[model samples]
Structure formats: C-alpha cells, structure tokens
Target: MYRFLFAIDKEISYSDLKTLLKKGSGIVVDVRSKDEVDKGRISGSIHIPVENVESDMSLDSAEFKSKFGVAKPSLDSSELIFHCQLGRRGAAATEKARSLGFKNSRNYAGGYKEWSEKEGK
Candidate 1:
C-alpha cells in the first residue's frame, strides 16, 4: 500500500523525499547518465539512465536486482521516485514508468542541482 505522508502526486519535493527516505517508504531512481552521475547523486538511490528506464524496469525481480542492486518495484508501487540533473529527464523517466504500469510513480523535480546545493554535495 502507498504509505507516503504527502500528496501522492506526479512530483515530489526535496523535503518530502527526505521524509520518505527516512521512513524507508520509497525508492529514489536517478535517471541521469554515468557522466552526470559521477558528479553526485542522492545516497541510496538507484541509477537507471533515462534511455534505459523501460528495459530495466521491465526486467524480472531477480534480473532487475542483479542489474540495479535493488528489487524491481512492482508496477503498483507509488514510491518509485525519479530524478535527473535538473528535472527534465526525471520527468521523462517518470512518464515512462507510468506508461509501464507504475501507476503512481513520481519525479523529484528539484533534481541533483537543487539537492546538492542544499546538502552541500
């Protein structure tokens, strides 16, 4: 079941994400490429570039886990939060996830830039 404390919308805020992570109530997906990711990313978030969201999310649980180091989130999960350098790719990935049946997948619209500046990354 969706345990999010805030509105279950298409986007999530940094403050809400912090609470989500603290609660272990969701998964944060970084949809940026290797070069972008090498700069920085949210701790504990899984990396699956925007170009690969469909193929990777389509993998079975075991394969997905082996590939991404995290369990494949069920299609019904509302906690698959996507993010990118400045939100564009994250929004795209979120749409891709939604198209794949992740009904309530959300994007972290603030992206890494906002996050890094806030966290001093």
Candidate 2:
C-alpha cells in the first residue's frame, strides 16, 4: 500500500553495484531462474527469481528470511537491487518491485554476464 515518487526504471552501473556490495547497504537479488543461478551468481546475492519476487517479498513469507538470512523488506527499506543473466529481466524485476512498494528498487544494467566477464569469474 505504498506509492513510489521516484522513477521505476532507474538503473545502476556495475561499478555502483560493486560499491554497494562492499558497503552492504543494499539487498542484491538475482532474478534469474534456479537453474541459471546454480551455474553462478554474484557473491552474497539473494536468489529470488523474477517470477516469485512479489510473493517472496511478503513479510509473511519465511522464504525470504530463510534464504537470504535477513528479514523481508518493508515499504521503506533502504534499497533492493535486482539483476539477472542479462539486463532485461533485471529491468522488469525492478519494475515489479516498484509496483509492490519497493520504491528503492533498481536494476543492475550490466548483469551477471558483464560482471563475470569483467571480474573473470
């Protein structure tokens, strides 16, 4: 039951994402499917597929806390960063998150592909 005042399509750079990871200021969510995630993912990112993001974000859902080792985000949570194998799904996931009251949601434009390639993972 929250309204967003910020742009829903906002995106974050790979560098900025890395910075956030270092400081641990945001919740990094991998919106890829389980199979894709099994292949690899950013260190410390929570695996919440785009299809199940909304449900998992619910405070009543224990999956979020059990999987991510943190409580579900409230309407005024700090930041929720979403990424996928590429940028497309991440962008869509960000939109979904915004619609669900996560106004701080952002998409990592350069997704796992760019991240792995750049980091040589």
Candidate 3:
C-alpha cells in the first residue's frame, strides 16, 4: 500500500508531447475509454483505460514480473504520462499513478480535448 501527499497537474503542451512521443523514452498511457481512443489518439500511446487500471488500481508491475518469470530489474519508476478527454481525468490518473509508486508519472493537462481543439483534428 502507498500514500500520496503531493498531486501532479503538469500542463504538457501538445508540441512537447509530440517530441516525447518521437523520442520513445517512455510510455504514454491513455486513461480515456476505447471509444475516445478510436476517435483519435497520440499516435502511439498505450491504451490502459483509467477505469481498468487494476484490481486495486495499481500498475501492472508485479504482473509483468511474474509473467516474464525472470529476475527482471525492479522499476524505481515508470516514465509514464497519462491523459484523458480533459484535464480532470488526467489529474486523477496522475494521483493514482503516484500512489502506485510511479515516480516519473505526469498528467497531461492539455489532454485530447485541448489537443484536438488546438490541432483541429
């Protein structure tokens, strides 16, 4: 079990997100639903809908380790960026990610809605 005292509301710009996605240095977890994703997404974001986070709302770290069945290096943090339709769900997902021990997690405040509006996509 973990507790989070600080909350994240990192307002990520669309251009910045594009840069990161190009770098492929981390994973972009879409916290939105499948329908939302089908509409359009950040090209390569991994869809892990916020509603199906986990049984206890945890990242699938332990499951990954077990399934791989190897002495894989324990993750200190997952370079995760979460987004949703608007900023609200992203903020909530950020809090949940922090509680689940994801240190480098961030909330893309300018989520899909902002991105779409900005790009006219």
Candidate 4:
C-alpha cells in the first residue's frame, strides 16, 4: 500500500516543480554534492548532498537534527521536489525519499540547467 502510494521512482515535469515552488510551500532539496552546490543552486534549495542521504544515519539523523533544532520531518521524508544536473540524482533522491516515507517526493527532470536557462542567468 505504501509502496503504491509513495513510490519515489517518478519523474515530474520542470513546470510542475516550478509551479509548486511558486505556490510557496513544501521543501525543495538539492541532492547534489557540495561541489555541485558550489557551482550555484536554485536560490532556496536545501543542500543535503546525496552522500549524507545514503548513510546509516539517514538525512534526518543527528547532523541535520542539530541544524534544524527540531525533530521535524527531514527533507528526505517530507513533501518535496528534488533536482540535480540532468536529473539522475533527482530520480535517485525521489527513491530515497519514498524509502524514508515521503509520499509527495518527486524528481524534476529538467534540473538546474533548465532552470538557469529559463531564468536567463
């Protein structure tokens, strides 16, 4: 039942993600590595870096707990949209998010390259 409902291995359109972001709720995470983030990211994305996500600690563990100061749902386990260069990492992140119980996670296939182009940056 959960698998059917929260399947994370799904691709969402770039326009859909952009609309969600403009609507002003939920989280947008960048599952890319730190070096990738250093190259510039979507202005408001939380950089969890995919490596931390694969650890036994999970993205919701002590490290982020201290950062958020609350036992809230981790970005990986929350309603979110993820993106990375070309979208592969975003797809991986969606699967991880579903494994962690996020029913509304999705991968933005167009990624940062698309975003930068749209924004003329």
Best-first order by TM-score: 1, 2, 4, 3
* Best candidate, lDDT: 1
lDDT score, candidate 2: 0.84
Residues 42-83, candidate 2: write the lDDT tens digits.
998888889887777764648667767977776666567899
Q: What lDDT score belongs to each candidate, Candidate 1 first? A: 0.91, 0.84, 0.68, 0.69
Q: Which runs in model 3 stand beyond 4 Å of their true positions?
A: 1-11, 54-78
Models 1 onward score TM values of 0.91, 0.84, 0.70, 0.73
Clashes of each: 0, 0, 0, 0
The candidate with the higher lDDT, 1 or 2, is 1
For model 3, residues 2-114, the per-residue Cα lDDT tens digits are 99676433556677777777786656768899899999987667676786654323425576446433222223434467899887888787777666666557788889988
In candidate 4, the residue pairs with backbone N, CA or C atoms under 3 Å apart (3 or more residues apart, or in different chains) clash, namely: none
Superior candidate under TM-score, 1 versus 4: 1
Best by TM-score: 1
Which 10-residue window of candidate 4 scores lowest in summed lDDT? 69-78
Cα RMSD to the true fold for all candidates: 4.2, 4.2, 6.3, 4.3
By lDDT rank, best first, the candidates go 1, 2, 4, 3
Per-residue alpha-carbon lDDT of model 1 for 5-121, expressed as tens digits? 664599999999989999987889999999988888899999998999999888989999898778888887878999998999999999999999898899999999999998987
The TM-score of predicted model 3 comes to 0.70
